[model samples]
Target: MSLTSAPGPGWLLFSFGMGLVSGSKCPHTCLCQTPEVICTGKQLAAYPPDIPLNTRRLYLDNNRITYLPAMNLGLLSDLVYLDCQNNLIREVMDYTFVGVFKLIYLDLSSNNLTLISPYSFSVLSNLVQLNISNNPHLSSLHKYTFANTSSLRYLDLRNTGLQILDHAAFHHLITLKTLYLSGNPWNCNCSLLDFSIYLIVSHLDQPGEGLTGS
Candidate 1:
């Protein structure tokens, strides 16, 4: 099925080696520049197939996408940014981002996702920012969830209904610069004592009063 509905604009840029071009194919109900394709609020049910191959930025927020098949988004291998927040996505399967090796920013917030396969982000070696906040159903983050994202600098897990944080969940994120854990019903008792201590010792700063339910 076609993944386009109408055209709209948002602020983001995606430039490649050849510089910006004109007349590049843009999905119906979308706007395309040499490096960016914006299609927000299109009520899209699936990914658009007609977007230019060289696109570096893509916006598909406020849609009805429920699942992201592995490598389906790999078509945009050069993508550096993606925004799919406020959708119905329920799970992040393994290798879902394997092809987007250059992706630097990703936003999958406000979805229905309940599970995140540990290997789902293994291939995003260059990713710097990741947002998975507002997923009320996502309650736990496995210790190895971020084992491969050594370059990740920012992580957002706010309002995810998290009650338990695996002690080693943030172990591999040595380069993480900022983290968001507010709005979670964190049981700051014994279970989180070590994790909390680790955060303090590691100097990983949280936005504000990140954990609650002590």
Candidate 2:
């Protein structure tokens, strides 16, 4: 049986954004509020430029955006919530989110992602929830892909088409809970031995708790 659990960047150029966002109105015809930017369904093809440094929440869902260029959102130091679901993103490059260390919630579901660089999210120290579900083309996760999100609590990987997980894939996720791994075709063999052993040792296999394939 496959394992399932539920329970569950860079600075610089940032100095320049501080000036552009100080008193700027929303750029690219997007909505702007005190600490949130609403750009959902605007049909944007790229990450909005000149975001306010004080923004705490950003919504970029249901758009045609294909790439999240490095430093695209790195200037928003105060950012804590981000939503980029249903886009055309094909890959997650390293340091793509360099300086938003305070981000606590993020969603990248329903994209066309095929690969995510290891350590892509190594800087998120306060992250608690993340969703990358529905990316059917993303079949593998390099070890250390989630290197530093020790505070993560909820993770949703539903419908991701993943077949195996590295035993050490989650070795550093000491606080993880509410893991959703349904809708995957897991190969239950020696490849899963370590992951399965981890589940048992972590108490994530306490009967009726994991792997409900779709």
Candidate 3:
């Protein structure tokens, strides 16, 4: 005689309100809006597990995701905008964003990345806009890779096949304001002479035009 134990207390409040309306719905192919969760180009290879855990903006663009293991987004720890553009990501292992530490706009453009493990932006220290531009087998860029992003402000390595770029690689980007090393192929020599004298003594913006030198 166990029909929920004799009609219990109103059937236990209608089965606890149907488990809170099935845990706040919206996830099967996503498109929620209570904190955004756009699931772009759903050709996703993974990661779409009933999102909506109070998601704070997440757009898995052009899916087919390849890899990003370490904690693998940990659980979108209150993420703040992330667009994995044209996926098929090759590598980015280290902590893999340690759970979006309140990420502020990041777009791994046209993936297939070569490598970027070391401190990978050191927990994104509240990162402010970054796009690993058109990664076509990204050549090299390991000088402490943005040195902890000190609140970075926009940086998009234009073409991404940068041959050599180690002049302290923007030494800690102390609030860097826009830096997009144009379509790379730059092998200027002398290790690019202190990054061309720190871009003419911090004049900054110069790395646009199709800079090719091999």
Candidate 4:
């Protein structure tokens, strides 16, 4: 008898084949698979693409994404790494990073962002390294932007096009050791003289490399 004559078995086989084909054609906007989660260069303009539930690493680089959705990112609970570089993101809305508590490293460089909202990174307590460099238009950071990020050690703000820093910009970052501000246009005037004095006194008390001017 021909395979088609076995109706029950043949129907089962056809359904299985269709499922396999569908699984093979995963959408270009997301890679919902094992081992690695690669979503780079997707050109996505929408928020929350269909990421895998078990995803550990996420790469959302080289897209046209301009804003993060207001909904909390609590679904990707297993995520450990995230890369959102080279996008057109201009502003980070409040509470935009909720539930991403396990992230260790974050890169938000090369974007059109002009400001970091106060308390923007407060909930990322486990974050160890952060890179926000090369954003030439970023000129200001709210006083409490890094207030609760106690575990942050390395902060990169190089070439950020800053002309002034408020006295409390780096407040509460007591654990911070290496700060990269090499290329910012820091204005060292009377308004900043107190902060400069504090740094000098603190540096002399600890006897380390001292501060420099523009």
Per-prediction TM-score to the true structure, in the order listed: 0.85, 0.86, 0.34, 0.75
The segments of candidate 4 whose C-alpha lies over 4 angstroms from its true place after superposition are 1-27, 32-35, 197-214
Instruction: For residue 172, give model 2's deviation from the true position in Å.
Output: 1.1
* Residue 47 local lDDT, model 2: 86
lDDT per residue for candidate 3 within 102-165, as digits (tens), equals: 8888899899999986567677778888999999688997787777778887888888888777
Over 1-214, each residue of candidate 2 has an lDDT whose tens digit, in order, gives 0112100011465545554655355666688897999999999999887677788999999999999865557667788999999999998876677768899999999999999888777778799999999999988898887777899888888888888888687888888877877787787777777887787677542223365442
For candidate 1, give the lDDT of residue 60: 88
Ranking by TM-score: 2, 1, 4, 3
| Cα-based lDDT at residue 180, candidate 3 | 81
Between candidates 1 and 4, the TM-score winner: 1
Across residues 147-209, which tens digit of lDDT does each residue of candidate 1 receive? 778999999999998998976877888899899888998877788888888778877778876
Residue ranges of candidate 1 with Cα displaced over 4 Å: 1-24
The CA lDDT at 36 in model 3 is: 85
lDDT of candidate 3?
A: 0.73
Q: Rate the local accuracy (lDDT) of all candidates.
A: 0.79, 0.79, 0.73, 0.67
Give the runs in model 2 whose Cα sits over 4 Å from its true position: 1-23, 205-209, 212-214
In terms of TM-score, which candidate is strongest?
2
